[model samples]
Target: MKIACLQFNPKLGEIEKNQNFASGLLESYKPGDIDILVLPEMAFTGYMFKSKEHIKPYLEDAETGITIRWAKAQAIRLRSFVMVGYPQIVKGNPDIYYNSICFIGRDGELIETYSKHFLYTTDESWANEGPEFKAINVDSLGKVGFGICMDLNRYQFKAPFDVYEFADFHLQQRTKIVLCSMAWLSNNDNYNDNDNNHEISTINYWCNRLSPLILNNNNDIGNILVVVCNRTGIEDSTTFAGSSSILSISPSTGSVHLLGSLGKRQESIMIIDVPIDDDT
Candidate 1:
């Protein structure tokens, strides 16, 4: 299967502009060229809203939101599975909202939806915590686990570092693929100026966070795949750590391989074609 990550800087509160920018970036790929396309958390709507009232206008209907419309269009246009993050208002309840992600099948239909189970600082300001970790079965991809930016971190970043809630869930479920959309904050603000060090650091940190699955590699684990699609550029005072990547962990050798990755300042898609070995 071929998977692609679209990484770009989205202006705050400018949803239409961001959507056009994303569409233009994906114009070159012909339909059916990409098997799966993933975007960063809050891919178009910028993160960092100050409060619920601050993001009120941008909250979308869980079933008919603009983000879902865009994702569905892209899914149909590319003939690929599309996953993106957006802020959602629970149906019939404008008072409740969640930072969520939705999956669109190749037919432009909603396949599944997952709200962020772990809220980051920014999210806590305007969104409610979601239910729990989950894995959905997509006929084409086997069991696929989902996670947003903060989900990979320790619960509220206060739990034992070794707990690995997200990775552990996927391991227990024997998930074949893991999809993560992130607006992960950058530790170094100057990373865009040809400073490759910080980008490497971020990638390493992510790999380590998911090391549980790598270390527990068994025949059942075969070749577990992970797609981390992150955005770039600074949003107000916050800068995102870009270096979106695709990786594979081989159970037989207990090894992790980097399939492809984007740099800190790139505004493009990182695509990789992975061959599945069913027999392990």
Candidate 2:
């Protein structure tokens, strides 16, 4: 099977422009070129907003909003399952919103949705905390779990490092694939030759956070696949770290293989061919 991570910079509040930019990135690929396509959190909508009132214009419905509309089109056009994030307005209450990501089937039907379980400072201003993390089964992929940007961090950045809440849940669920959509920021504001190294640091931190699953006792199954789709570019005072990558972890040997990755400043798609365990 093939997996793709679309890494690009999205300007604040420019949904249509970002959509076009992302679309142009995938133009070279024919239908079925990718089995699964992942986009960064708030994929087309810029990540930073001051308040609920500030983001009202960009809030979208889970099903019929402009974001989903765009995702569905990509899913159908590429003949691939698409996972992307957006700011979602609560169905019954217009006042409520969540930083959410949704999975669309190859036929462009909604498969599952997961809101951000851990809110970043920006999310706290206008989004509600989602329920606990969970995994769902999808065709070919077996069991797949989803996570937004802050979900990978230690809870509130205060939880015991060993807790590994997200990784533990997926390990318990025996998830074969973990898809993470992120708008992770660079530690430094100034971009320099060292930016690439900083992106590597972030990726290493992410892997260490999943140590529980990486160090799992189960040696019977194949390596688990984790795909992180992170964006690049600056939004106001924040500069995003864009080293989107696909990793394969061996449960038996505790090895983490980086299948492919994009640079911190590259606006491109990283595609990797992965071997799926049919019985997993």
Candidate 3:
């Protein structure tokens, strides 16, 4: 299957602009050529919207909202499934919002939705942390796990890490692809105007340190493939260095392959062909 990862800098609180940008990317692909397209966390409304009230009008229902409807149409038109993140208001609890990743199947069906299990400190003020750790299944791709930005960092936590570890073990027992959506930030010094020779070294260190964890786990139970899409640009004094990529793990030898950086703070789509095997 060919999976595309979209790495881009979204204009903060600009939903229509972001959606238009996404549509342009989708238009470039031929029908049935791409199987899945993964987008970053809060792709619709960029991270760090100043007010919840301001951001509220842009929130969409994962199943039937205009965003999903447009995505569904694109999925059906392109014959590809889409996994994109957006802020959603939970039904019956209007006051509380959730950071959600919605899965739209190739036929435009609402397959499943996964709310972020781990919310960053900044997100805690506006969104509720998801209580469930569930995996979604795609027919050609096998069972897939969905996680947001901070959820990756949660692997360092004991209890949540245990759960994630087990989830990895179980997915390896069935599938090969694990999908992640992120709104990640590099160290502030890396992007500062006054250049420091050590800043480049610092950025590389942080990227190398965190990148591999997305591909192979410490437990070594599964040889999984990771497709991560992250946002770029600065928000509220925090700058996201968009180095989103696809990390592939060889099931037979556990070898790892890193493909595409998509450049910092720019929008682009990366396509990778993932091979599935009997052992994988």
Deviation of model 2 at 157, angstroms: 1.4
- CA shift of 34, model 1, Å: 0.3
Off by over 4 Å in 3: 155-175, 188-222, 251-254, 278-280
> What Cα-based lDDT does every candidate model obtain?
0.88, 0.88, 0.70
Backbone clash pairs for candidate 3 read none
- For candidate 1, the per-residue lDDT at 169 reads 86
Q: Worst ten-residue run, lDDT, model 2?
A: 189-198
Tens-digit lDDT track of model 3 for 231-253 = 77677778886767776655445
Off by over 4 Å in 2: 192-198, 278-280
Candidate 1 structure quality by residue, lDDT tens digits, 1-280: 8899999899989999999999999989988689999999998899879999999999987679999999999999889999999999998777889999999999999998899999999899999998998898888789988999999998998998888988888888998899999998887776454643327788888888888888884865578899999988888888888889998887667778888888887888888988877432
Tell me the lDDT of candidate 1.
Answer: 0.88
RMSD of each: 1.6, 1.9, 4.5
Candidate ordering by TM-score (highest first) = 1, 2, 3
Backbone clashes in model 2, listed as residue pairs: none
